[model samples]
Target: MATNLLKLNNIKTELMVVASPSQSKEVGDVLLNVDGCTIRPSQEVRNLGVILDCNLSLQAHISSTTKSAFFHLTNICRLRPSLSDPVAETLIHAFITSHLDYCNGVLYGLPNKALDRLQRVQNSATRILTNTKRWQHITPTLKHLHWLPVKSRITYKILLLTYKSLHTLAPQYLSDLIQQHSQPRSLRSSDKNQLVTPRSRLRTFGDRAFCVAAPTLWNSLPLHIRQAPTLETQAQMEHDPPGSLTLQLQGMRLSTSNKSVEGYTYNSFTLQLEGLNVSQESTYPVFLFILFSYLFIIVANLGLAVLVFVDKSLHQPMYLLFCNLSANDILGNSIMLPRLLIDMLRLPSERLISYYECVVQAFTSHMFGTTSHTVLMIMAFDRYVAICNPLRYAVIMTNRMLITLTVSAWGVPLVLVGILLGLTIRLNRCRTLMKSPYCDNAALFNLSCESVFINNIYGLTFTVVLFTASIGSMVLTYTKITVVCLTSKNKSLNSKALKTCSTHLVVYLIMLFSGMAIITLHRFPQYSDSRKLASVLYHIIPSSLNPIIYGLQSKEIQNFLSKLFKSNKVLASK
Candidate 1:
């Protein structure tokens, strides 16, 4: 049947039998005949670059790995004299370390004698990279290089795979093998993010299966690590702390200390901002310009919001969305500019921010930015309804609908940003220096030492979703509005619709272009200064200009301001 299935699938098969040492005697000389081909069982077979023996002891695999690693190490050593340090390190990692780490997860629960063989290969590579002599100890050197010993590396691999499986990021086969611990009732351990460790009947072979071993190691991790929202955060929380290497080398079981894991906790961070990079003579003038710009952004956005709230005529749906946009602008700039202004007055070295403050700044800034985009999208929809369905505009865009849209615009971004910040704030940072003048999600993310694949995925997903939804909605609405304006016979209505939309279109275009420039420039290291300037402008320019643009374009606001000024003049004359 197996041969028939393989034939049906067009697969050519070579089969082998792997038995434990005790069963090998009973299963001696097993042979089979299929399709006129005689196949005899072998003592050892190479599968997927790993040598599997009949006893399943893995000794053959270790010997093969060490032999291959030493071969490359010897060649690297021969060329080491002429190679630079960085090049030599890269070569060692590419050749020796990769071989050692590849598929090391399967090496879990291996005897010390077997693991030591792989460890020796790692020691040799590190020694060769650092030019350390045979007489010297390799422990400190390995610690300095931040290399985890073979056993610990195996554990890390297993735990990482387990995390991926739990998060649905792994293959379905792997995911099916693992399950999260659950109970019918609330318990103290319910929230611990524990995995269900499957029972294995055999201690030697069955226990080493991924299903059994993965959960065993995963459940042993710190609670904080297991609860981490992303892989990078988990890695940072589980990173090797001081003395972990020594424990591994001493043949002791690896255990993480809560204190050591949290030892790198920072109360504050110093920002290394690259402002306009002006000379000392130009610093104050530039500072003054930025200061006044901030002042204008605050006053203009707040005043516009206040005017919309106080005036009954401007309480329409479009104006209400505009007011929300204004509030978001004020919020976005206020999160960044006040600190920026303060930092300008202080010495560069004195520019410090508490950890929580930085997190809050990043959270609020991104939240408000997202809110701005959503508000603009809502505004576009508002204009669409008012222009295309003028007779039913009041019915469709009622006060209840407007309030709901407004609340969602703010609430949805808050939830998204909150999740983002929750993940980001828990990351263990390896560095505190930020090159830009402000705290942002990208800057905060770059400070972590671990791989941020999950964070990047989530952040990119959020950005794509926001951009797609907002841009798609605006495009669809505006297209309908354009069609209405062009096809309509009433010239007066067309002009009014066009005038109202022109202001929003201008604002949206400015925001879209500035945001795109910042996002694009961030990918190139050479344009770092330009990127920083663009980031600063992304916050301030829209806020500072939105009020001026709306005031000049909207007749309702213009007439309201004119009336107030004329009334003040009449009161003064009386």
Candidate 2:
């Protein structure tokens, strides 16, 4: 070995051997002779800043780290009085904490007593930086500074390497050690990004092997986090400091708890939205078109609604319901479009919304949809009373009755959707990416890592009840109107009733078919492209068409619009 080293221009003095724990006792008294060079068996070897003992206990490494850390901490404490807080923190981190974290992955699975020595070093460094008294607790200070405990720091290092290995960003040796768990047949967890944990015979030694320990920790993370597309995204999902990853090991639950091992709190989550799959060239054109559609929806719906509010002669039951429908159109599109427009200008990766904003958007969306259907149902009833019981219509649909119905139309949806969003807020969300153009109840609740069975049941039940009540009431009222029309002897009454009901019926059918198409397209992934288009259209089309249908088809509204326009022309001429 010496002669070979000489041939390669390397010195033989660099060669050292620390025997395995099993052979340590026998080799402790023995010396090695290779190619006329005499070498002694070392009890501990220092390589690349880590001290590895014959038994591989890592005690020497930990002791060296803590000693060096305390040495730096002592020096920093002496100058801490002169240094500002930020400068002091920088010095401490540079001198003390960095030493503790150097190559700390090899210290995983050590006994608590062994790890606590290094923990004290960190705790002291934190205290000196913050000028915190020794009698005070340290956990809060560590959390405030976003520092992980020594044990968690060790786990973080290992898991980070594991993540890199799985993503092919680590060394080939590490990538080779990681094996993805696979099955011959599909299972419930088939889509979960799980790794195969190799079997280990000994708890102390075998369990610490990279192949065993890496998979064991990797599989414990939530499925959504494990499946994050990028390392930055995974770090964001964990809600740790910029470079650290939080885990639910040793009583921690992804920073959800305030106990030990819990390093940070999640103040808010940023969600990623998947908008239309437009090419770079088409993005601006698509955005402009969507902007035009949204502006039109606002102007048309609000214009019609304002016209109804201003014109006292058009204050009858059917026109009042038309006004309600117009308001709903403006609201529904507003809930979806403004944020969507802003997101469209951003890159796909930059399309982000806060957790609270998402919940509000979702709640308003449900309210807008449900209230629109309710108003349509109410319109059918209004037509039924007008055509079938014209004499009693004035008496039945009084001012008080109109107020009550309008209030119910808006208030009931608010309460129901409030309850739905309340359920969603209580869930602990593990995923931050939403595969939708905008926030909705379905998309928001699906981000939670836990089972949303209850949310699904309640949402489905609310939808079913709302649809049943709206559709049933409309069908029964229209059926009665049909029977009355066919049997009535008055041609004038028949013609007026058909004209009035046609506009409402057309608007209702458009909304119903568009909604149904969106729901149907979601069930088939093959129709994802179509689903995105349909979802966008579902919000904008009904809103845009309702005002046009009412303005053109309803004689009363048309006459009112004509008079308003003529008066405007007369004033302009004057």
Candidate 3:
């Protein structure tokens, strides 16, 4: 009987072997594969509802022969065919996990409220599982088990056994804490007020639960399970704490390592968890640049507006075009820059934007952008109209015409790309971890769970059309100016015309090409960094540079700015 008992229960091993009658004639079966745990074929593993056919008394844990264990080792083996064997790893997972729950009363090596919650939940679950008839098909008959809690003595002993299991699982933490428990250092008198914990809305459990359980659970917990009292004297008030119980169970130890973005592999008494591997891609600076740069242009344009209004001499077609171009650039940045910053700021690289946001950006960015683009085209046309036909320019490009034109620009984008925002394509489910600070269109598209075939297609089409139109109009407009200058009879007018057209061409190329190039690079995975850098140049940096470039290059604008600053400084000093 002693030999039989020893063979029947090897508590030290992580693998729990149970026996039952085999469903088929096969004597030996492949129970599990540890890696990639997948079950064996249904009929093959079940062998027709039987498990332990050999009938070894120790192997009774697997056998459904006696109405006890229905989910035997055999069924598990078939269910989880793994490199590590489904039968073994699952049993291991459950055993350690369940035991940890019971012992969590340990916090910082002391039995505390956290551990108490675990114990309470465990006891309640065990009570429900034990008392209900539904679980009986699994456990041995309640009366026949030697360790079954019987008298008060048996109950107390079982309680000790549970404490021992907890200590082994979470050795680093305390079962509960005292003032000197975790904080080994001493506190000064002035720091007393700082020592008190805050009363917060976030904590789930009441303070009393932890406060009460702290001291009680810690001292009573046993270090080892083998020393736990048997069913006979378990009820007796032992009074003394059990610190050194023998550990007979052999299994992988646990860890509380708080590393992020990594997985774990376990070994005996030691666990190895891989650390996070960061990606090489970087693009956040570009978004930031876009945001700040456009803001500066807005400020500079407003300043220029104040200067123009204050000085009647400065109010002319050229200055008006300058104001319009600044506005276009400001509006252009507004389309995509702010939201890109917001997305980067709010979530990690992995979290995808809502379908609507992606569509909205794709569409409205185009809207504000198309408006800006058309406005840019108008700016070029205005310059042409002014230099070529200065006398008729006022009548031709009146304020009303400009207003109607700006409205047209806004409306065209609203109508065409409007559908992009309302629709959501369930593309690839993005990893919640954000790669960049913002949720740019490309980032969201990448994170999608479904196919982005349409998004990409429409995106490409819009890019080519809008980009080509804006650049084409600006280039063609400037080319006409160059031709007019070469052929014209007046040297003074031609010189001014050449200078103005050339300046606009420089600004136009910088604005259009840089932004378009960055956006295009997003399609290629390998060039993401380069794309981000380009976006920075397009978004914030260019906006900042725009005012400076025009202010420095144009003699009329520089003289105007110098007088305006002198006026401001004089006003401030007064």
What candidate 2 gets wrong by more than 4 Å, as runs, is 1-268, 568-574
Give the clash total for candidate 2: 0
- What lDDT score is found at residue 228 in candidate 1? 89
Tens digit of lDDT per residue, candidate 2, span 160-203?
A: 89999988999999999989988899998788989998899777
List, residue by residue over 436-486, the lDDT tens digit for candidate 1. Answer: 878888878776655677788889999999999988998898899889988
Find the candidate with the highest TM-score and give its number.
2
Q: What is the lDDT of candidate 2?
A: 0.79
Instruction: Quantify all predictions' global Cα lDDT against the true fold.
Output: 0.79, 0.79, 0.46
**Order of models, best lDDT first:** 2, 1, 3
- Model 3, TM vs. native: 0.45
Ranked candidates (TM-score, high to low) = 2, 1, 3
Question: What does candidate 3's lDDT look like per residue over 284-373, in tens digits?
Answer: 554455566657767876776666667777676566656655665666566666655554444332334444544444554445445657
TM-score of structure candidate 1: 0.56
> Which wins on TM-score, candidate 2 or candidate 3?
2
Query: What's the CA RMSD of model 1 in angstroms?
Result: 21.6
lDDT of 2 at 76: 88
> How much is the lDDT of residue 104 in candidate 1?
87
